[model samples]
Target: MAKTIFNTSEKSNFILNMTEEQYSKLASRGLIASMLLVPLFTIIPEVTDKASYAFSAGGLAVGGVICMILALIGMMKKYIGKGAVIPVIAMGALVLWGVISLINGYDLNISMYGYHNRGEGLLAILFYFGFFTTAAAVKRETAVKTLINGIVAVGILNSAVSLIQIFITNKHYQFVSVDDEAMAASGLSMSPIFLAMVLTLALAAALIGFVTSESKKRRILFICSAALFSFVIMFTYTIVGICGLVFSAAAAIAAVFALKAPKSRLVSVLAAAVPAALAVVLVYAGAIGNITSYRTYDGRIAWWADAYMRASASGNFNSDIINIDDPVDVYTYMNEKTVDIIQKNPLTGTGPEQLAFPQVRKVNDLTEIEDIMTANDGIFDKDYNEYLYTAATRGIPSLIALVLALVPALLIGYKSMRKRKSAEAFTAFVLTLSGVLMFFISCSSIAYAPIFWAAAGTACAAIEKPKKKEATEKSANKSVKAEKEAAEKPAKKNTKAEKKA
Candidate 1:
């Protein structure tokens, strides 16, 4: 009988076709690109000013698009698996909107709009791609730590550079209003929004480190770094960032307590007091007005008031029922605008490129601005609202697709809570919670699509446990084969010995 040789090339081909590792690597690269792009975008915005926001919707935004492309390719090749579906759905919706905007634009014409619209749609799609891909590629627990560490490293470097620049230029003092010499001063920095986002990432990572790290050295370092970031955040006076941090801390404490994590009573007491401590800091910093508003929680009531009034007038009471806070009202107002736009254009919405156009038009006719006076409010021009931006621009189908993509990831996160002991599960829990916060804060935050995709990937990676019995069975089979071969070898040796004798 002739011995057969296994085809190594065929096995290699099979492995190459099946492994998620390649997709993961690409996903990590996408994340790295996004982080680097953040600072670069800040620099460009500072220098050019005209094209500052463009880079955000351009290069950094394109990262999400590329990620979606890679994810689609991976799915087509069968390497993506179930984890890729959410991103694909998000990307699909974005692409559909992009196509629609190119064709059925409601008289909003700009040579740059299509380019920017596609870019925006692509950007949102790419976020999901990078997020999901990272989840698929990296080990669940390790990826979360890596993401945190990466954010911390970026925050530290950015903060240090800003400090050094202020020192070197001898521009130690700056004014917030450009005329108020008595106002608080800070180093060279980007807009409040970008600064807030970085600080938020750093804060989240620091909280995670404080809770999970075993090393005294790392714990100390995290504390110092967190304090520095918090101080910087306050100096920036980005109230939104401060609010996010407070919420995250509250979330961390709640999660820890619920999990019954091993910790001292002192630690638990401190955790319980965190919100109060944060309020004190906010008051001491002079960032807030009227501390009693904090007690009644009336300080942030404007958003809900705006939402309820608008919803009541629109007769859209269903969406505005949760007017308990400014946050809910803000979310309702944003989503309602989108819901309104979507009712008109359900198939594609407004098109990815025109995300802000419809909202802008709804509020003002730029050509007729002199007649309307609505443009005087400035909010219509800026379009800080997310739901309105998406509905007016990307349309409703894209938003629906976005919701579908995110909901599954949320389910996965919910499942992860079952594994309360695992670090990966905790990270997913945090991300899912963050997504929820972002949703109520503004639909635009979750509407990015990429965040949700990443959330889904993290959820899947965290919850999908390996079966120990299957692994044991494989090990047992290999041992049995080895013993049988050994027994046959002795029989062959005896036959040879008898033949020689």
Candidate 2:
């Protein structure tokens, strides 16, 4: 009866399949592998017609399958308590709405996989939900810091790729560029805009590491990495990237002031102003334009199969969107169209991946350049805003579920941030806060969405209160220490009395 609940074989730590610690480590390994490898994926355009973007989907599928397995295993085995699953349940609701939307959708193929270049479809959403669940359900350990470190590692590698491409040789890394934008660097990601968001995520984690590190070497390392990530983020020229960097840095500085700020409040204020000042100078100098528009609307290639292979190979298909001259125009038109899409279906609007070619002039022949020039119905694929996009695609309840998924973790993370809790908790808060805000203003893609979800899951894990077992162990240890002190007190008193005598 003593150990029957968890049968263990001798010389093995596998109890009831695997311990919670092992489960979490495996999940981390899977997630870290994707974070490190997914963005770096690429293939030559000559190899396949869909070479520009299919590899990313392949990476998502590989990573998603692993995450899904871990999530299902954890759910079946009851790795986490019932109370810990509220955020996950919220995520499940998002998935449920997505499926329902898919079922009611006009085209199963389009809604299931989304547009070709931008795959924000139901399948991709399912994968992201799996990742969020895996991250949230795992029992967080001190080793959770590794996830932050992994982002830093990705930042460093991507920075190196971009730096070399900028100063040394642009022609060297053709595979790195999914599009032909020579002025900006995209690292191994699909586009510079998407890469910017990823670097922002890395920058936030590195800033946290910099603030919390006590050792001089570690501080130097984190600061250098943060600077590198931030520099590349500027080159990407995305508003969300720049804003996230400044906000996350400022937030981290505020939190760290509790530990080791100069007594003068003036010094603290100046310290916080530096990041803002840098951003201002960069924007004013015109070094940073809105890279978001570079990948903006009018991308003609939506679905490619055997039928479109010849058309694609013959150079009839233009995969990029028609670039608008002004970012304001781009945002305005997309937002207006998004509203129309939402209004049309109000409940589970248009399904996931339903709207690719907005107000199409010729829906049948989307590839021809002649047709694309005349038929500019704002060629919008994904909506600029994530909140509106979620509501438009999944419906009002799904949007509420999305909010529920974030709000509780956000609230807990805020508490952890204010209290200056453990490094893990504070880092989680920063990750979740910055990532969520960044994506709120941008589209949800596999490129940046996974990071946000992973952050949310990590935040969920980090902000949990201590368990009853740990509380009991702590009390027992304290009582033992108290008894030992009581027993020793008389001996010390008698010795003192003898000396006095």
Candidate 3:
């Protein structure tokens, strides 16, 4: 059976060098990547990026996170005894919000099942709860490398698909998720924003790998992977995504310098950071391509301002809509319209996923405002600002609650990085930070949000592994051995003395 499984065609070198235990350990380590691969490669061919592909992929990834967290908990039951309480309380906020939405909420149907083409509702929040649970429950430090490997593989596959789409098909393909920004980048679930988030995390992991790895071949592999992820992020062209790579690279290199490792490893981190930095400067300066939009800063500010206005004041926007060419004009009007909504519904504002929908919009309960919204048809589905959007839809406390939930994991990863020299801890810290930052630019999608959530959990899990403990044990063993040797020397000396007498 072993011969059949291993392919007997290589008869000349049929003997295996690895013991069964070694092989088993190798296969076990691959489990995290194996489960993640199901979602990484899954794409519903018929729908493309419209709906089910993203939803299904997200569901699968969430399931995988849950399964791994449970398995890790079982393996480390004693480790979680005292640690599990805080995580449960932190994550239980999701259940609280979900129950409120179900029991006494506006439009229970929409709350339970989010609006069309968007699945970020009660269900999505619960899945996130699962992600935080992983962070709270997991104790395994060995799985960090495997998780990073899975992320790198997904990012590489994304870049490959995008390259093929850009060159061969002329920016038209359905193999991976495609969007209007399909020409910008492809593969995985989103266009520029979410795809950028995934690639950003991937680049961070690769740089971390470069910092941690000692072997020449493994170091080269990590640098190459970092380069590949950077190239894809360049095509993304979004400000946050591009800047994320540059800043995260700088941070990683700086972290390596701070680590006890030889200053020589900083070269690999620099190798990853320089090309990405150069690209950002050249492209913005019009050396690579005429992407004037990035240079003219007014456009993005106006875009975000418009989203804020839409989310904050659903009523006033339809009838008294002012021309938004001037950023100052839009900002002034947005502040005017949104204030009343906050004053009225401070505790639980409107409902879940109800932003920019006329039928369910509760920005103002005035009859005239309702008529205008119904007639005009609210077009903006998302506020593009998650902080304000969350406060507006879920209320101010909900947003605060969400932040509080993540605080523990962030703190855990941060403490680990500061107290000890662990590349895994720093990588998780940076990834979670990036995820939190991405919210300012875009909303969470099922496709890429898991990466952030998983990172948070992995951050909590970056404790000292058993090997470090064993090394300390070896030190203790050395003293005992020395004492035994010392006693034996006296016995041998006395025997010699007796023989001489």
> Pick by TM-score: which candidate is best?
2
Task: Give a tens-digit lDDT track for model 3, residues 217-266.
Answer: 87788888888778667656556566667766876676677666677777
Specify the poorest-scoring 10-residue window by lDDT in model 3: 172-181
Give per-model TM-scores.
0.63, 0.75, 0.70
RMSD in angstroms, candidate 1?
9.2
Measured by TM-score, how close is model 3 to the native structure?
0.70
Candidate closer to the true structure by TM-score (higher is better), 1 or 3: 3
RMSD per candidate (Å) reads: 9.2, 6.7, 9.6
Among the numbered candidates, top lDDT falls to 2
lDDT of 2 by residue, 1-501 (tens): 222344654435344457676677787787777666566664332134556565666677777888888788778767645544777888888888888888877567757876555566788888888887777766755446777777778778777877765445443222222343334556755555567777877777777677776667976787777767766666554566667667856766765765453333223324334644564465455444322223322122111111022112111223244334344555565678788877878787777755543344554666653244234433444565788888877777778988898888787667755664666667777788776786566667676776667777777763344477799999999999999999999999999999999
Candidate rank order under lDDT? 2, 3, 1
- lDDT scores in order: 0.48, 0.63, 0.56
Better of 1 and 2 by lDDT: 2
- Model 3 misplacement above 4 A: 1-42, 45-51, 54-58, 61-65, 68-78, 81-87, 102-110, 170-182, 268-270, 273-344, 358-378, 462-464, 467-501
Candidate 1 lDDT over residue span 350-444, tens digit each: 55444334544244434542222233221221123444555556566656665665666676566656754664466555665565555443333
